[model samples]
Target: MLDFFIQPFFEFAFMKRALVACFALALGSAPIGVILMLRRMSLFGEAMSHAILPGAATGFLIAGFSLPAISIGGVIAGLVVVLAAGAATRATDQREDASVAAFYLIALALGVALISMRGSSVDVMHILFGSVLAVDEAALLLLGVVSSVSLALLAALYRPLLLDGFDPDFLRSLRGTGGGTLYHLIFLGLVVVNLVAAFQALGTLMAVGLMMLPAVTARFWARSLPGMMAVAALIAAVSGYAGLLLSFHANLPSGPAIVLACGAFYILSLFFGRVQGILLRLLPTRHLEA
Candidate 1:
């Protein structure tokens, strides 16, 4: 039992790196996931993940698989899509969700076309699906920086973000005070940065899974924002650990295995969570005297 759980990380350098990457992702992306869930922009994270692909592919086209080039390119592309979607929503009758959907669809197609133009199918698979066992030092460093930055920003803007999610009119009122727009932009930037970091470990397709599943599961267990974020991070950490182990023993893809572990947590939370699980709902509620 001890070897089954602990030997992989101790025996293999790749496993240790993969676990570190997953921990970085859990700490950074999971909290942001709670925020996204609060704002009801869950799908937006998924869209932004795809939005970064063209930039990554472009980086690959220009500089092979260099991390700096790919990360810079991806960050630029993701931010562009976010800014464009915001602009379109403000300028036209289309809603933000519609605008984001349109742009991500286009961006996804463009990214694939660009990758196919200069790279082989294997390269495409590697970019889209990722190889967590192959994570290098540069990628780990990037994840650490991204996670630290995201946590700092989230702490700085916690109140404003809560206001933005729950009371948009009030947050809008603070726009002239350098509150609304600034906070909004910072939040979106953080989203893109986290996604780009996640792309390095989980690939474009599975990146959002690490961000979202834990958050969604946390929702069933926690009612307060802080509690929810904490639960989400814990869930993400557990899923990452279990997923890596599953992948090692079963010869499975690391990214998908991690995501599946998150999904399993989601299912269990839905049925057994303390706050909102099906079992809880099915139980009789005791009335308290005032």
Candidate 2:
């Protein structure tokens, strides 16, 4: 069993790279997902995930999968959507959700069109599905850089972001002049950076799986914000390690396998988690019957 757990990662270079990439992704993206979930923006975050694709597709079109080009294009595309959404929400009576949805749809269609013109159907699928086992040194480096930047910024903005997360209307009243626009931009920037990094390892579609599932899972077990973040990170790391093992043994795709591992944890937690698990509810029922 130890060999079963240890051999593939020990023997294969690509597996090692995949493991590192997954952990880095988990470290960076999971916290952001937690915060987004707290702010009730999971659907917007999902839309933003697709929103990065047009730029990534454009980067692929122009640069043929070069790391820098793709990352840059994705960041640019994400920023455009965020900025546009922010402005639209501010200027009109339209809700941010509606505006964000509109931008995401436009971006998704443009991304699809761009990919079709640039390469085969396989390329589009690759953009959507990803190839984590194939993550190379350059991709790993990109992930590391993004992770470092995201974590650093998260620490710096912790207090403001926390206030914004829970008491945003009050926060807005205090900050004045549109209230925390800069911090909000920084938040969006971190989200896009993480998304771009995840795009390399998991693609746009699969990327959010790692980010969101762990967060949702954490919510089942954790009471405080910090507890949720810590638990989510641990869950994400475990999911990465276990998913890699499954990918090696079962010949599964690494990205989706990792996500499915997260889903498994989620399902188990839904029924058996300490804080909000369904089993806890049953305990009360059983007690009343007794």
Per-model C-alpha lDDT, please?
Answer: 0.94, 0.90
What would the C-alpha RMSD of candidate 2 be, to one decimal place? 2.2
lDDT of model number 1: 0.94
Instruction: Locate the minimum summed-lDDT window of 10 residues in model 1.
Output: 281-290
lDDT of 2 by residue, 1-290 (tens): 78999899889999999999999988899999999999898887798889999999999989998999999999999999999988899899999999999999999999999999968988988899899998999999999988888888889889889988787777788897466777777898898889889989888999999999999999988999888988888899899999989989999888889999999999999999988689886775554452
Clashing pairs in 2: none
Per-residue lDDT over 77-184 for candidate 1, one digit per residue giving the tens place of the 0 to 100 score: 999999999999989999999999999999999999999999999999999988888999999999999999999989988998999889977888876657777888
Once superposed on the true structure, which residue ranges of model 1 sit more than 4 Å away at CA?
174-178, 288-290
State in Å the error of residue 20, model 1. Answer: 0.5
